[model samples]
Target: MAPKRMPKVYLVRHGETEWTINGRHTGTTDLPLTANGEAIMLKLGDKAAGPGKLIDPTLIGTVMVSPRLRAKRTFELIFSHSPVKPPMTIDERVREWTYGDYEGFYKHEAVAARKAKGLPSGEGGWDIWVDGCEGGESAQEMTDRADEVVRTVRDAHRKWYEDPERKEGDKGGDVLIVSHGHFSRCFLARWLALPLPAGQLFVLDPGGVCVGQYYHDLGKTALGAMNLGLI
Candidate 1:
């Protein structure tokens, strides 16, 4: 019962945008959700928020949202049912991995472009997690950013977990994040103390939800759920 009061982190991926639909690397470009994106987000709001849902509005202590319009819009949709707005941080740290020169290009296109430019596309070909975008962030940079996200989330959770009033019926709130697909995966990998490439091990769809909770105590974190579709 004491463990149940331990706060969890709710990871949410933004809904689809035009680039998302076309299989393009949408990084740094602020795009709004599509009509279908909005519809799906609305459906997700119904299933994800409120009582007995994966994200209980009243139980959200902090929200870390990407500065991108798509991610910000996703938060609005998810918590549309909330009685009061939760505290949020429009953190650039959770923003998508900027594609740089590969921006707006598909994975294959980026690979082909890299090959044409006489760049090392890796033996297996252009792996963003390994080689990274030509002019954008490197794997190490993303790792550091992901580390920051983990720390901030842990701090938010600590408040509820260590509260003196928690021994009673005080159920602490959870930390929420509304970010892009790749970034969220990376963040989760860092949360689990795994390498950045381990992010490729899991896939998170647009409007999907992932949950992480403390195991044993607040010191050890475990994946509660991943790639869960609300809509």
Candidate 2:
């Protein structure tokens, strides 16, 4: 059996907002939480506090969030009852992608624009990932940023792993991450050392959480459990 101890990452995507429901690329816009979103997060908090085979509330060490208002609000409301509050930090590298000209534009709108512009269709052209809306991020640009964030966090947490006395027989240290949708998917791909394009494989929704477990003996590998939606 695997040891009771291991390092785990609990990922929480912020709750739904009007933009999310509309299929708009929300990137960097600061949208407030919907009432439905708030309720889902409250339930998620209750779930976190309950006992589980692989998760324990007390073992969580840090709560990191994107600086955006949506993520911060979700974290604040969800952990309101925790007596042993961990240190919280905002990381820009983990923030939502800057959508640039694409901000707030709907999917069909962009598709129509692509057809009108007669942009190239493959490898380096107008597909949703590679093509920016005139002046936004190509999927590749976002991937690079996600990779940098994952490495930086992993490196900084080496101390958690280095300490021999820190619960050698439990789920060990954990981090609670609250972030946006698109970049969160990208983060998952990078964490698993998958090709950046592999991010396209994951579909994230509002009020959903994904868990990633890292097995040290197995090397820096990421085991992802995805799309645990609060709804």
Winning model by lDDT: 1
- Give candidate 2's whole-model lDDT: 0.71
Candidate No. with top TM-score: 1
Writing each residue's lDDT as its tens digit, candidate 2 over 1-231 gives 333455677777888888888888887789998998787777766666324422355677666789988898888766765554555688777788787766888866666666677865554334555564467777778878888877665753555766666464543367677898878888888889997667788877776778877765426767567867454
* Residue clash pairs of candidate 2: 5-170
Model 2: residue 185 alpha-carbon error in angstroms:
0.8
What is the per-residue lDDT of model 1 for residues 93-128, given as tens digits with 9 covering 90 to 100?
A: 889998899989888899899999998987666998
Off by over 4 Å in 2: 1-4, 49-57, 115-118, 121-126, 165-172, 215-220, 229-231
The lowest-lDDT stretch of 10 consecutive residues in candidate 1 is 164-173
* Per-residue lDDT of 104 in model 2: 89
